[model samples]
Target chain A: MTTLLPRAGARPPGRGPRTAARRRERLTALGMVSPAVLLLLVFFVIPVVLAFALAFTSARLISPTPAHFVGLRNFTLLFQDPVFFRSLLNTAVFAAVVVPVQAGLALALALLVNTKVGGTNFFRTVYFVPVVTSMVVISIVWMFLYQKTGLVNHLIDTFSLGHLHGPDWLNDPSTALPAIIFMSVWQGVGFHMVIWLSGLQTIPADLHEAAAIDGADRWARFRHVTWPGLRATRTFVLITITIDALRLFTQVNVMTQGGPLDSTTTVVYQAVHTGYDQQQTAYASAISLVFFVLVLAVSLVQRFLTREKD
Target chain B: MATTPTPAPGPRRRTLRRIPGHLLRSALALLFVFPVVFMLISSFKPDQQIFADLGSIKAFLPVGQLSLDNYTAVFDRVPAGRFLLNSIVISAVTVVLGIVVNSLAAFALSRMRWPGRRLLLVLIIATLIVPFETFALPLVWWVNKLPWLELNGFHLALTEGWLDTYRVQILPFVANAFSVFLFHQYFQSIPKELDEAARMDGASWFGIYRRIVMPLSGPAVATVAILTFLPMWNSYLWPLMVVQDENLRPVMVGIQYFFQLNVSWGQIMAYSTMITVPVLALFLAFQRSFINSIASSGVKG
Candidate 1:
């Protein structure tokens, strides 16, 4: 927090060594920052602007002619497109199901491990192993387990009490997206659990002791103290999980490839499919633009709702 | 009314009560580890045996016809070594460049007195909200037209495009805003007096950065390296779009080649296991700092 800025009114009557030194410092600062700034400008800023511009044109990846502007045709077509609607719905459903489940399980796991227990690090590492592993690797491994005669089914059959049977988890349109959701929550919960654990650690032990002395039971103590203490962490985890859920591409791409009837085609997946596989750059940009706005709006709303009140 | 004398709960009873929770936690941890263990164990088993053992707990254990057949099949079916090498090169280059580029940018903003520093920082951070998928297609078009310099045998040649090259994968990711932000936050905590002291001794800004800032910022560097390395190693969609040459494809893209008709489950497991080992090893080695970094930054992996 130290002020590195030179004094505002330190001007001498004439140009001097101090002024020259100040200018040199500025030049050096710009020199150091220019490489990253240049990269971001070229890669991120330009592409983002180009994505918006491309969304208005009938652009194709392999077309020879320059793309002609098509006005709002791409957006209009997307609005009426059944597959796009399905993808949007699927993404919404995925997020709605995943954010709560992952965050809740993470919080529960955090609470469980936050206790003064032996081998806590062991459990933490074990839970977090999947989080570190690549999503593609996890998806491929889980795809094996989700097969008809796979480990999950085998487990179901072994413990079935004579009434249960394992279904084709990935092939069934009804169950495919949910199956992906299950694996995602399994893989991702540990990350948020760590976040929650850190948040829990920041809560002072004396607050719990004070609540206990005031006749608060475990549930009551959590309700009055822990939950309130973790409000900011909860907001953060919610936004991050929401963002992750909305950008659901890797699992679907690896496991189902948008599935048996586009049941698992998320917006991000649909955008990629359209852009790369179908080679409809403009349409894909339109879809991506809509998705981007949706995410931005959701994030802004979440921030507004969670903003601290003085 | 006189209360009846109740036996005080012994330490053994309290300990016994905690056992169920501990047991429950262990079971859940096993649930998390089960797939990874299954991937590793099944990698050693034949395809038929993998399916055969599926009906029992034996599927998870290293028993019944374990060998290197699946691993060999993985190598035969795909260029596993080539893919691994590509990924290693790509991730290493990205990490090295990312640390340098991002830390320098962060250093300038965090340490140096400059105009509009706060504005620049905010602008850079705002880019995080824009997901890569949104700009990915446009970036493909952009990079395809971008020029590059390549060595053709003994002659150095200027190339027109960056597509189908290692630099494409490495360069776009070099200037990650999150890494910059993390470095910036870390730099802010470093006292400015150190910079002033170094400055008084005629140390240039770059000298101060290399000699003083970076040496003291080991934790930040590790955090950024891990953060940068994970995404680069796990990158699939971008490479799939930009990289066309089989030799240039990273490990994740090499995965799709196994998903053809008559999918080789054992081979897939083998490939997955091979790819996952490096990640697990890295995490295990730096588990504390990795978790601490994520916790402090509130960034998901």
Candidate 2:
């Protein structure tokens, strides 16, 4: 194991069998990587570059007219539009609420299921069913459940014995975004729970036992040991949840269509709404560019915030 | 944390402590499963009966006149079978191609020393931070103008645009950044000495990748497959943009068809259940892999 690896530095001055082998290896590596590179360049790289370039052009999705440079026209229009502003605010609000709520809930869940008792796996599996289930499916089912005569209202009626009525959840503007936020959290929290549980497991049990021996109670041990151990998982959960919250489109597209006076409209939802539905490729690109900037800014801030103090 | 060499809690006290945990777990588990259970249960009942039973606990239980009537009605209402088949083919192809391509790239990056390897890896990983929604509109516009070479009988013809095709759905997703990262991370755990030994045995790099590295990478393969398949199967926004052909629509987009006018709750539940059950069954079957892979993806953070 102590033997030093023979790198290119180790190769004697050129034209040796080892040199030939190294060249062949490099060629094979290139061949192997090219397929992935080509695909990514075509799909991810080009499109991302296009996202930037097309933002300043008057490009239509499927038009006969060639795209012309439009300068700040799209941005000016975007600033003037109230719906886009609402969408951005809604995205921020969604992320602001979901990041903490989902991450905290997931940590709680991870701790609960991390016990070495029986049925932990069963509990984990049951909790993860919604994570595996499609958001589209969830949105549809919850749409039904949120109806005026749905199970949610019925349960409210039953619990109150006909004293109170649940609001029309997806229809009422006030409750629409909150309702979607709740479902989004429910659908995604299981994923972060697994992440947090893994982090918890990596925290050596002896630390907790040592803390316990030192008279640290449950909360004290958690604060000192468990919380510190979950730094990576916490960063992962918060960032993923925030990104996901900001990309809140499926439920909006499926359940509410960003409806009830655009209360539930998210940046991504409006991006799709304008990009695909209206075919204004350039304008949609502008929205998407802003969306990308928001994601980048938020992620950078999160990374900075979650960086290890030491 | 439970492993203690010293005097542990007495058996009665331990049981009492576990009691709260069990109760809490049971309660949380119930809360998580309730909506799915309601969807499944409601899929079988008539619309009226679904609402009728909603006032009671029976909303979640399979009570009263249960039938496959709504499931059958789902087929009558839309081309559910076509959507299912489309999603299956699209997701399956995407997963397979993704594993092959991404893992190969990972093999080259992780197992060999080459010029530009480090730069390529960083570039690929950098794409991971950008969400799909950010570039989806531009991708849509780009694909709309991109050309495809299609075979017509014996002739190869260049067809413009990939909209309304399976390739549009599958191709863009085949070179996933995270899958490549996963494979690279997994490959690093394999000792580099093995590659040298294989080279000493006169094995070519591709040979080593196929006969040695790939065969040893079952867990990575499964992890990549499951992760890739989930998004592909649940792919709504992409296909909703690209595919307008009813015959080419995936299941997630099928939900939109039910939303047009007079909405049928039972049929919606039925379709939702139909699309969701297969993924759930797959998840339960590969529960450990699903859980562990998602957990391990925290390596990025």
Candidate 3:
């Protein structure tokens, strides 16, 4: 919106002066924003540049120096390494499953509350509590709840069903990542619900009333009135969640430590493990570089789709 | 045309209007509150009780199991007091410094007619899309180099550690890209006439910002503080990397021992409860404002 601003004297409202003022305005903007621009260069852009450089060298943690140029070696190693491949596969599966499930749940919750069905404010507060609580604390709480003889299994036993025994959630190789994903969904669903609720509000009440007047059912009103208004909100939520899902690390670190045979070791986790634990800074940098590109790609694709819809 | 006001809703109509919707809404609210209710209940129960009797609704009945032992035991095993202080100090300092720096930069970007503003604004927004981990290591190295930039001549040490210093932990996080973006967005939203009128009265750039822009942007500042504080307090990875000394760790990091140590469930429950209550209370106080900011941002397009 600041783009609407004129340079100092554009208030005179003439032709040549306005053009010259625009040029000067551009320069003045550069000077004004230089501090932030410089900070980003030093901290964000520069680090990314160094990460790329480090990917080509053997810069181990202790060594501090680029020991030697080993072009494509780290990248090649990542391809051949089974752990790297598995981490990638695990991340993809996690994102693919969790994003849609969480979004869908949020939509359902938002609809229920938006219609003034019951205690909307109370329900909103309850759903959003997890988002406020620290992830570390939540992870620990869920860890206890997911233990071998934990509450989940005890509940299963009450059903008199032998097949539904809950395993040690964080300890089992197969279930560890999935368990973390479930916790993430629980924590994350609220934020999306808030966004969807806002979208639901923008949907004019008259549309719903009109649809009902025309003998439309609940689903039809939602389809024709509610969903159309949600397009922008949906796009924003999708991009934000995708970025968050792709960058999943905290839960795995706190609960599983990417364990039970490394089933939960995401790209970010592996990068941290490589740099800190294994002391392979260059390789870790390479992995991080890949993760960065992946995030950028997903963000760009979402942005493109959003722009197209607009 | 003579129109008589309608009588207040009849008893039968009122009853008919309220019953079904009230029941469904209450039921839905219960589902949302269930997990939190479950959490509070489990916190009071013994570890063995949680595991053994999870199936029974009676397991959560807050009759005899409610105990203060866990809360007291938590205080015994950890420096709970110091952790709380650390969280308060860090979050308070970050919020204050973050507002000052971001507002200054945002004002400059919004009000100043300078070059490269568009490019700089784009850079700020772009940084938000990327994860903070990308900058973590390199920023650490940058902070370590700060001491060398002092009056003393530079020396080539392979590694100059700034580990465990509040400066190291806090300085790197001071210049928040999101806050700058948020402030800029808000400042732009304020009508230029308010700024122009102040300037017309001979208010300088700084004068205009202080008198006109600052007072009008109260909601924005509150939004910035709430958004920034929660994340700063809950943050773990950056704190873990920077603070080698266990004593300097924040509450979130300190709470990790509840899992790692072979502590009793009472202790664990107490620590977790302590850590969560302040946050839960904060959220309750600002729930409407919090949701309002998020909703506004999301739907603005």
TM-scores of chain A, one for each prediction:
0.94, 0.94, 0.85
The TM-scores of all predictions, comma-separated, are 0.94, 0.95, 0.86
Q: In candidate 1, which residue pairs get closer than 3 Å at backbone N, Cα or C atoms, i.e. clash?
A: none
- Estimate the TM-score for candidate 3: 0.86
Question: Where does the lowest 10-residue lDDT sum fall in candidate 1 chain B?
Answer: B1-10
> For residues A1-310, what per-residue lDDT tens digits would candidate 1 score against the true structure?
4454554555543446567888999999899899999999999999999899999999987788989999999999999999999999999999999998999999999999878867778888889988888998888888888888777887787787646777899999989988999999999999999999888988999999999999999999999999999988988998999989999999998888898899999899999999889989999999989989988987888888888866
Off by over 4 Å in 3: A1-38, A64-67, A159-163, A305-310, B1-35, B41-53, B137-159, B296-301
Query: Taking the tens digit of each residue's C-alpha lDDT, what string does model 1 give over B104-156?
Result: 99999999888988899999998888989889988887787798777899999
TM-score of candidate 1 relative to the true fold? 0.94
Predicted complex 1: DockQ? 0.66
Per-candidate fnat, comma-separated: 0.80, 0.89, 0.48
DockQ of 3: 0.42
How do the residues B31-83 of candidate 3 rate in per-residue lDDT, one tens digit apiece? 44455556677677776665555667755567455677677677777788888
